[model samples]
Target: MSKEIRNLEPTELWNNFADLNAVPRGSKKEEKVIQFMVDFGKKLNLKTVVDHVGNVIIKKPATKGMENRKTVVLQSHLDMVHQKNSDTNFNFDTEGIKMKIVDGWVKAKGTTLGADNGLGVAAIMSVLASNTIKHPAIEALFTIDEETGMTGAMGLQAGYLDGEILLNLDTEEDDEIDIGCAGGIDITAKNVYHEVHTPSNSVGFSISVKGLNGGHSGMDIHKGLGNANKIMNRLLYESQELLRISEINGGSLRNAIPRESFAIISVSSAKKDTFLKKINTTINEIKKELKTVDANLDISVTETSTPKKVMTTISQITLLNTIYAAHNGVYRMSNDMEDLVETSNNVARVIVKEEKITILCLTRSSVETSKFDLANTLKAAFELGGYQVDLSGSYPGWKPNVNSAILNVLTKTYEELFNSKADVVACHAGLECGILGTNYPDMDMISFGPTIQGAHSPDERANIKSAQKFWNYLLTILEKIPSKN
Candidate 1:
């Protein structure tokens, strides 16, 4: 066990989290962790079932006389988003996370801490192992691959679970309860490009944008941070006459905002120095504009070996125009919920390979019609740019029910525990609750968790004190669950 979390309060939770960190549990590559969980269930003698889609369900009988209370499902995804700084050497497939403690928060060294859902998974494990906490009949559902595609939640069969209430331990804030979340879809645009020999009397250079605070696409879209892909395109479009593009690449996962991007281009030798000067001047101006949110942003150009092939002028224009015209970041605000984002899009990734160039984006909204409208808008933009667009992985939003029994119970419990009312809010980010609700329409669900900052990026950290508070609140809620009529 790492010394950092070895003696933390709520010993069981931190202990289990330490073990989880030792396993390689990146999205979709969860075999070892799946087996580990199964072994844990077997060791504890709990009733465990592994579904076809790799979701793990563990059933625990009520403590003593609480059997008459409703069956509550404590749910969290098993997979964590893997992100690291460009200079970090960690591998998600073969290595474990390196943990540290800084300012009372548990974080990783130069990589994502995996506290997004790993902490939730550890909480469920600790609850299952406890013999002291009083609670209703509990079904702990550990779904897989939530960060990327949500394939585990997607494949969950209807009637596969027997719970009237679901407690999603996936939100980031400690004092806010999330009752609703936005749905989202992924849009991809692809087009073939023909490469021609680089124009004579030209020199090659790499223009790169880096040091921006890329974050969770949906959660951080409104922060006004610089998007590396968008900024690079803007520069290219401004210098279109003097350069011919050879390659363009940026971002990674579809759910993360693009933090860095690089483009390889051939510039006329006679104008190379002037072009570099203009690029540097423009970069400084853009940085000034985004100084508040992206203070560390850097854009630079460096000479590189000459490339034999470059995208034809037509292909280069089409790609650059499409990127420049794409809509990214928050597009609308919620009318019903103050300060909540209603609709947004993130230009998540751009890739240029031998056969084709592709742009991957995600659009999210709480309103179904609005979601489709944004998807259609993306389609039109790509088609106008002479690329084929495909939309997939569409999921519905969870509509808040103010009169929910579980919500009332949770609110009362929070008030009694902390002497203050918890804020009932809706999240702009997509959550599995929306997808799971379709399979169990009547499942009353609420999502809340300890404070996790900078999720989906290398800066992610879980507040230590908040984890204990979250645990206290959850256990109290379990004890206070209403008995069946």
Candidate 2:
């Protein structure tokens, strides 16, 4: 807790967030947050229910004279993405998020801020606790495991919610209303190779790529930020003449762009200085090439402990080729929407474990056929390189229904409250609405939120002014819902 973190509106949001953060709620591990919401509902004496998948639904009766209005569901995910800086030593399983305020923005000290949906969660809590705001029948639906997958929403029963109109408070931009989102799939390639004990005359060294700005692969795909894994592959390909590879590893989450990566290699003791000089020269050249985008990018090498065994020559070549051939960055932009990315792939994580190497890739596309095509392409590449591929955790995309009654009402409300038209569009990121819509076919939905930057990454932050505007807009929309009967 720093001195600068006190007295901000996001501080109030963080206080509640800290309570939620203290409990481990990573993807499938959402029982604790579910209980917290259940207990909060009990304290308020509201009608509360928890599904088998730990999704919590809390209902608040309509205000006097507004009981006739249709029930509205305020939806947000209960889980936050688990990511941290390489140097920060906090464990996500037990430690609370270390948050602080800088100027007027709220951010984490060295981790993701979780404001992607935490602010929405807190705003709903604030609304539920307030006795002054006037509103129609409301249901706060907190679904679990929205980050890793949409398990909670996917498991939702048809009659689980009584609301026909759903307001998903999950989009990152404030003034933009997101009506659709891209679907995603996870692809993994595993290769097991024999290791050989090499002579002790070889020196062990580590090569690293650092200082690149990595963000949400979906939102920042077009930003031209260098992927550390890709950068490392390029370095290895360039320096293979001077070094022998041993082990390589980087990244953790599939949704976030990797900012840094490192590789362990072996070289003859006599060639150490030349290897270092060559790597430095390559780093300088890459920096110059990416000067406009990754100005701070750096590549460095250092001496390290020798490995007991190294990959065989055949295995090493296969691994290097596979990594070099892996697809990355934006694959295509939407032909229908100018400047919008329709398909993309991220080679998120690479690890060497127990004589085996695993590469995890995440692919997203607004178009269903494109997503499958990208997945097939990756699968074929891995098979050609003689590796076993596994595909799992696929989620469907949510398509926009511009003709819905809820969108009509939201558009009118925005005009009435702010005297400006809301920017309505679709996104390439995943949202829970797609799964919820599948559960309840007739449900009408729209998503909006305060401005949040760098979501799912360490640079995450929320704007205070945008939050105030979001709260005001929500209050206006609540008071204007049409009657059900």
Compared with the true structure, all predictions reach lDDT values of 0.90, 0.84
Give per-residue CA lDDT, model 1, range 1-485, as digits (tens).
Answer: 39659689888889999999999999989999999899999898999999999999999999999999999999999999888888899889999899988989999998889998999999999999999999999999999998888889989998668989999999999999999999998899999999999989899999889888888988888888788889988888888888889988899888888888988889989999888877877787899999999888888899998778898998888888888888999888999999999999989899886748989999999998999898898899999998999999888888888888899998888999999999999999888998999889988899999999889888889999999999998888898888886
Q: How many steric clashes between backbone atoms does each model show?
A: 0, 0
Which residue ranges in model 2 land beyond 4 Å of their true spot?
A: 1-6, 10-15
Q: Cα miss at 378, model 1 (Å)? A: 0.9
* Candidate 1 local lDDT, residue 35: 94
Candidate 2 collision pairs: none
The alpha-carbon deviation from the true structure for residue 479 of candidate 2, after best TM-score superposition, in angstroms, is: 1.1
lDDT of 2 at 346: 92
TM-score of each: 0.98, 0.95
